[model samples]
Target: MNDADLVDNLTALESLLQVTFHDRTLLRRAITHHSCCPDTAVHDSYDTLEFLGDAIISAHVVEYIYRTHPDASEGEMTAVKSEVVSRRVLAQVGQQLGLFPFICVDIANLRTFNERSRDSLCADVLEAIVGAIHIDQGTEVAREFVTRTVFPMIELVSTHAIDTNPKGRLQKVVLQRTGHLPRYRVLEQSGRHNDRVFLVGVFEQEQLIATGKASSIKEAGRLAAREALQLLQKKDKRSSADDTTA
Candidate 1:
């Protein structure tokens, strides 16, 4: 994007975020996607800002949980915090802000092409915004931003005991075992809007591990991840038994 377009995007984003940036350049960097921009000396992309935002999110959310849920157990607190800081929730918040329209990215390599990439990109940009805001305004402003947007999700997480992070869990398993992340592909979608069924297939290095179906794609992906983990567990058990016998 040209300087003029960049300024226009920054203006739109600021309006959406309801904050004025003291460091306009910082705000610009937050929305700059590495896939579409030139690398700088200190950083090539939002990676650095995203890292800072992740830490800031954790610390702020932890403080919120500690203060508000004093009677909660360690496990309860852990669960709630996890949901609040999860990629899914972060991405949801980003989508609500409608930041995709203002993001600077390569047309062909757009994050909107794939569901996974879109969610990840949105979450990353949201985090980058948080990081930029903290740097430009201060921790207080950043905390307020998160408290208004991300903190309320805690209620939904606490109400639902089952976590919808199978993809994340399966990702760890695949990375540890084969040095690759598991992939989720949408196989089929059926039914009406209020009662739709989605079938998602989980693949490890091009081989299909399992397929899952649910009312929502996210739930279906989680089911597929669980199946993949079980398969790995069985394989591990067999290997352990073989070793013992030998």
Candidate 2:
């Protein structure tokens, strides 16, 4: 894209972000990915802006959550923070904002598109946008941007624990409750080459409670573990009610 096109694009982004940039160059730098060029001297990349934005994002998020949830304990706050700042969460946010089409990547030599790398790039750009907003506006504006955009996304995904590492969260809960960790095992593998599929089961005390299937083993395991976690939560609630009545 030429200078004029770049300027138009940045303007559109600023409108979408609801913040104008004082230094339009900073906004440009925030959207540019390093993979677009081999030279480190390139000014049109989000890496440096991403670095600055990350700190700003963290501080803003922590402060918002700290004030919003005064009754929440430190451990709860930490867990919530981890969920909010996680790469997966950020990538989802980027995807929601349709940022991938604007991204410039160097993929000519690669055999396949690296989803993880793409996600990271998206996450970095989100952070860079945050940085640009902070620069263009004030800290209060930046904080509002973070609260309005990032926090709502986090909360939406957090409800019902959808699209999150529920197994990991459940494991922590289980460890605190029973002092025993859950385990996962591959039940079956099928298909050929790139079309492979895996089935996994989650177990506690050698008794299987949930099973899931996915294209990747890790995904299957996570799904199964999440199912197991849900079941365990239901059982725990029932047991607690029974004890209370007794």
Give the winner by TM-score. Answer: 1
Candidate 2: tens digits of C-alpha lDDT, residues 1-246:
898988788788877777887888777777776667558635677776787888998887788667554434587677778878888888888877877766666677445678787887789888988887788787888889888778885455444453466677757755665678878899999999899999998776577879989999989988887777666655765776788799
For model 2, what is the error of residue 164's alpha carbon versus the real structure, in angstroms, after optimal superposition? 12
- How far residue 52's Cα lies from its native spot in candidate 2, in Å, is 1.4
lDDT of each: 0.80, 0.75
- The CA lDDT at 95 in model 1 is 88
Clashing pairs in 1: none
- Model 1 Cα shift for residue 213 (angstroms): 32
Clashes of each: 0, 1
Q: What is the Cα-based TM-score of model 1?
A: 0.62
Instruction: Please estimate how well model 2 matches the true structure, expressed as its whole-model Cα lDDT.
Output: 0.75
User: Local error of candidate 2 at 219, Å?
Assistant: 27
What does candidate 2 score on TM?
0.60
